[model samples]
Target: MRLRSLLFAPGDRPERFEKALASGADAVILDLEDSVAPLNKPKARENVHEFVLHHAGETALLIRINPLTSPEFEDDLAALSGLHPFAIVLPKAEGAASVLKLAGSLASAIPILPIATETPSAIFEIGSYRDVSTSLCGLTWGAEDLPAAMGATTARRTDGRYTPPYELARSLTLFAAHAAAVPAIDTVYPDFRDLNGLRAYVGRARRDGFSGQMAIHPSQVEVINHAFTPDASEIAWAEKVAAAFAARPDAGVIQLDGRMLDLPHLKLAIRILDVAGR
Candidate 1:
């Protein structure tokens, strides 16, 4: 799927689910984890299950289950078994082994999107997913939980950027996703009201090779989508490059618009076309 923006909706709030669907996000994440309180976990799961049963084939749906170690994990899995979301977002994932363990438990073939570096162990094991790429759809990281897990006073800098350690974690997650041959999804922007900041952050993520971003609110979806989609100029350039390469397949390197284009540049041009088509 062309996942430029994946928006979140609290699973317990079924009233908001339809609104989230209409928010223009490429995917919707029904959150049954941190968004729901301990007492409300069961109800949240039910709401999500019902919603999925009714709308499973309509839109790309994802469920964010609580961490496997939490009391709610098994119930979450049991409740969601037959509904079959597009993918499950496993929080606090420490490595590929964790993903494999979950995949082994599932009765169906559901791809996984792991929050790969939300803990110290997760950061250390980022490279482990390279071997488990078949079952993984993407790799994402969360800053809010990791810093708390690490006992850090702050996850963000005074200038609103991620702290240095968190920045490293984000970079590692991006690299791990690429190594695993899956999309790299940036974490939520947090400040739903800061559209300018969200745009800048999404632009930076796209520039850094991230395929998409998570949105905490519906308002952020459009910004993320626009930031990731190939613009008119980009599409034009990709088309020209592709045509030039096709015309001279025998030449390993060809001159395009006075610039020497090599195999790697041609490959990138093709990728841009693929993404634009998506």
Candidate 2:
């Protein structure tokens, strides 16, 4: 699946659901966490339930349910049990045990995409996700909740880079996803009005091995998609590397341009070509 952009829409506002689906995002996540007020969770859960029932198989849709620690989590799961969305986005997930428990409760093969970083302890347990890799749709992180949990004033520095602690969280999320063999989706850019900044953010994310980015607005979708997609230059480079490897099938090493290329570089070239469907 092409998950270059996963857009989020508030679950309580069903009016925006169809519009989000039409926004050209690879996935539309109906979010019931943080965005919806405490009093509004029940209504939001129902909205998500009905929306999934009508549109489950039509698109790559997922539900961002309340955290397992939240009171509404069970209700959220029960509401969607009849016919689950393509995947479930479990927020504030600390480790593999919570994911496995959810899978056991659902008793289905539907994938789970965990927001792998949200609490202080979550930082230590990032690597444990490898145990539940089979049911994982992707592994992503969030910065907003972590600062609140840690009593930090902000998660970002003055220059917009994440603060040191959150930076560590981001790195662990990236590593965990790769270790689990799933897409590493970066957190939302949060500034929908700044297209140039958004572009730079997604560019950095793709370069760092993150395969997708979460979008808060439709305006961010195109930029996210373009940034993650291997461009013509990248495609050409990947093709050249692949062809070089093909010609020297029996050789264990090769040289490309002025650099030494070997098994790892060849593997990366193949992955790039595969992502481009080339």
Candidate 3:
């Protein structure tokens, strides 16, 4: 549940599942969607089912199912019904209605981590998930498919940045997740070989209020985890804020270490402690 870094492993490559588990990622996603070839869909689903049944209790596992409209959806659901992985990643999710429909169809009560703002329509409907927060654990965005869906040249800029439109989508998804009281997870960095780029990306995400990030490769996990975790300075500040607030519970504001602390500052201190505990 404390997802600092969630790595993806292709469902067809069942042999890599254990390797991914041992890679020190907080979670591992068995991808049945984009990572699997079209011809291997059936095999991928079967392998995921077998993997789930065999390793359900060993690690935090999530299955990234194909889009809802895909022909493989029903079988995907059927294969996962009894296995009960930690959660399901609903790709290309457009709104709360889709999440509700899927929740209603499932025999088990698994929490969903929906890529809520992937397509253009999805960006418009991101707010709708607030009404169905009970069925969700988190919300994330995807940059890869949305631009292609809209016939855009690219989601990332020439300088390896997200264009303004995609940036808006990412920020909106972050706000929507917080509004729903669920964790906001940033999308993958795509450039698996660029460790420096990945570190900078993860740092930006943590600073921008994302609780965690999705990782495309195992090598990216440590950097993401380090970025998201509270550093020593942060822990010291949080402790000071907590002490100040606790010592002056009835005061509206208190000055601490040459700075004024208020309710907002106290709340952030508590959050830091909570995350640190995790």
Candidate 4:
């Protein structure tokens, strides 16, 4: 449940699955969707199914299946019928309706982790996701597919920051996940070689309240995990806040580090501790 970094590996390559699983990611997602070409989808699904059936992982194991709109959707579901993954990642998910419809094809109650923003119309459908919160493992979004769907050249500006529209979409995804009471997982950073950039990117994500981030490469695992994990200062502050609340259970507000601390602040401190797995 502590999803600091969810790493993705193409399902077609069974050889790389073990490597990815051992990459120290909080979770490993075997991707059967965009990563697999149309001609390779069947083999990829087989590889994923076989791998899931035979292997045991310390971290969560997930499969990213093609969208409901894809002709391969049902086939993808069929491969997972007898096997249980930690969760299934549904790409190009618009809203609860589409996800719920896809649920009929699945054989188990395995949690769903959907990429909620893909199409132009999907932007308006986030509100409906709140209804399916209990069924969700987390809510994530991707920048690549959405822009492609809109016929845009890129989701980012020349400076490597998200453009206004993509930024809004990212914020909406974050808000929707929190409003739905699920973890807000940020999308992957394309520049895997740029560890400094990955650190800054994931640091910003944590600052903005995203619970976790996705990684497309193994080298990113350490940086993503470190970025999301609570450091010494954060843990120490949370400890003090918790102690303050414990000392004055009936107090409506308290002072900490020369600042006013309220119930909300106490709650956040507790969350930091919880997230840190203390």
What C-alpha lDDT do the candidate models reach, one value each? 0.91, 0.91, 0.90, 0.90
Instruction: Encode model 4's per-residue lDDT on 135-159: one tens digit a residue.
Output: 8999999999889988999999887
**Candidate 3, residues 1-278: lDDT per residue as tens digits?**
58888899999999899989998898899999999998998999999998999888987899999889999889888778678888899999989988998888789889999997667888889999999999998899999888998899998889888999899999999999999999999999998999999988998999889999999888998999999899888988999888887887798799988887789988888888889982
Q: What is the per-residue lDDT of model 1 for residues 180-265, given as tens digits with 9 covering 90 to 100?
A: 98999999999999999888899999999999999999999989999999999998998898889899879899998899989988
Clashing pairs in 2: none
Clashing pairs in 1: none
Q: List the lowest-lDDT window of 10 residues for candidate 1.
A: 269-278
Give me the runs in candidate 1 sitting further than 4 Å from their true place. Answer: none
Q: What is the TM-score of each predicted model, taking all chains together?
A: 0.97, 0.97, 0.98, 0.97
